[model samples]
Target: MHVLLISQYFLPETGGTTNRVASLAKGLQSKGHDVVVITAKPSHPEGVIWEGYQDDGLVRDEQEGIPTVHTWVYADFEKTLFTRLCSYLSFMCSSVLGAVRERGSFDVILAFSPPLFVGLAGWITARLLNAEFVFDVRDLWPDLAVAMNELNGPVKIGLARWLEHFLYHRADAITAATDGFCESITSITGPDTPVQRVMNGTEPEVFRRDEAGKKLRKEGGFDDRFVVTYAGNIGICQGLDHILEAADRLAEDRSGVLFRFVGSGPVKDDLQREAKRRGLDNVEFHPRVSLDEAAAHMAAADALLVPLADHEIYRSFIPSKLFDSMAAGRPVLLSVDGEARSILEDAEAGRYYPAEDGQELASNIRWMLDHPEACTEMGENGRNYARTHCTREAQAERMTAFLEELIG
Candidate 1:
């Protein structure tokens, strides 16, 4: 099968969407499928073109034998409404043009979303090429933006909502990354639309527990501390203020607890300011690290933190960090509600607190700190569970089977 994948973010961009799409592409290639990824130059979270890469409209590269096509997009790391819109629109135009110029016969076109405009491009290309187009809904788009108050003006929000509907209805098959998203899309687009819940998973080899990482942690002053690390985007969706509050509550327990936030996003500045204002000496902030570095950090931590804002849209969402933490044999400290919490409890991977409940989160943190042995046990359980359920091999097999059915 010849597959064309369209996404704004890709390899070297340290986000869930990038990792998932890369893994899927590689997996498909390994299974004898010819996969071509059409993506923008590496720029996300910190929306700047990666060093050594030029934004010259389009460039083609090969990673692990998969052909990847990168296109130029206007993006700056600044987190303003106007800039984000420009970034999305730029990618939409560039990707459509790039896809058209490439002109390769494809069995199917898969478009991943957040900036749902990519789906629009896939729809247009599929129409032109007479190929099946699958829209991979990673998040419920404009509705999620609306929920976060990111789309402030009423008119803009309305237009975005309309576009969102248009994309959903136009797709051949919709693949949602979460069950909640699948249900929501089904409700909105009707049961007739093919929607499958293909979750975000980790590549086991890349994210397993590492003794070297543990040694690095000890050398880096993490020997005595019970580290609770949040190793992903620090965006608005992640209500990190609650984590700061938890740090404040555990400040007096100097010997036992430490909070490490090892990522960057729009909320990083505000989180740092809040931590300083609260005099959270227990908390430490680190810049976003590469995939290997992040894996090492996760392996070193006693527990991983997954915090989501108290919003209806987030209930169905499971942050990819949770899966990485589980793969690293690190117990999770989840402050997310809904389907995500359900997954943790079913696996017995970690303890959960209500979203935005600082006191409850602090109490859970203290409990984990006191019960080191229990934490270790939970970590082991999580690793075992992840090996079976959330590994790349498992997810890829499922995705390949879905594609095969579509092609047949």
Candidate 2:
């Protein structure tokens, strides 16, 4: 089977959607299916195109032996809603040209969505090629945008809602990243459209426990400190201000607990400013690192944090970072409710605090700090659960089978 995968993000761009699409492409290829990727040039988070693909035209590249087509994007650094839409729209238009450049019929066209324009482009491409179209939803947009206050005005909201419904109705099949998302899709399009939960997972082997983090601990003078690290995008949805407040509350306790952030996003600078203003000496920030380096950071920390803002739209979100943290054999400090909280409790891998609740977060941190043996047990439980249930290879194989079944 020949599969054309469309996404705004891909390998070398570190995020959940990129990881999901890349894993599926590689997994399909490993299973003897031909996979072709249509993605934008590598500008993400920072919005600066990576080196070697600086030209304003189509670039053909190979990612782990899978054929890929890189198209031009707007590369918006400002991150305003208009600029972000321009970025998504530019990729949406260019991805069609990239698909045209492929010049081959596909058995299936799989599109990943967040900006949702990529799904629009994939729908267009599928229609042009008369192939089966599968819409892979990572987030429920327009609803999420409205919750974030990013999409407003009746005309804009009406159009976005129309587009969302249109894509859901038009797709040959739909795959959601979470069960909540599955339910949401089902509610929107009803039983006519097939909706399956294809969870975001991690490569357990790549993220397994290691002592490499000891070197980091020694270098950073954190040998005596109890470290809790948040090692992904420090975005608006993260509600990191609560973490600062937690740190402040802990600062007076003299527990030697430190909070570390190891990623980048639009709100990173603002979060840093807020931390500094609040005199949060226990909180520190680092730039984003590669996946390998991220594993080391996780290993060095006593616990990993997975937080989401307090919003109803976030109830469905299982932050993809949680899997990697668990796979790395570290206990998680999960601060989200609903589906994610359920998973954490089921795995016995972590403790939860209500989102945006500094007092609760601080209390959890204190408990984690006080019970070292319990934390170790939690870490072990997490790793075991991740190995048994959340490997990326398993998810990819599941997705591949789903696609093959759809094709059949």
Q: How close is candidate 1 to the true structure, as a TM-score?
A: 0.96
Candidate 2 residue-wise lDDT at 234? 79
lDDT string for model 2 (1-408, tens) is: 989999999976877777778888889999999999999999887778999889978889898787888999989679788898899999999999889778779989889998789889989999999899999999999898898788899999999999999999999999998999999889889898888898999888888647788888999999889999999887888888888888899998855988899989989999899988998889889999987888889899999999989998888988888888889899999988888888899999999988899899889988887898999999999999999999889999999889988888
Backbone clashes per model, in order? 0, 0
Alpha-carbon deviation at 126 in model 2, angstroms: 0.5
Query: Best by lDDT, which number?
Result: 2
Per-residue C-alpha lDDT of model 1 across residues 1-408, encoded as one tens digit per residue: 999999988876767877888889988988999888888888777677887568475788885566888888887978788898888888888887888788568889898898888888889888878899899988888888888888878899888888888988888898888888998888889988888888888876677757856786888877877888888888888887888777787777644788898988888998888888887788899998988888888888888888888887788898787888888887898977888888888889899998898899889877886788988899888888888899877787788889899889
Q: What is the lDDT for 200 in model 1?
A: 89
> Model 1 clash pairs?
none
Q: Where in model 2 is the C-alpha error above 4 Å?
A: none
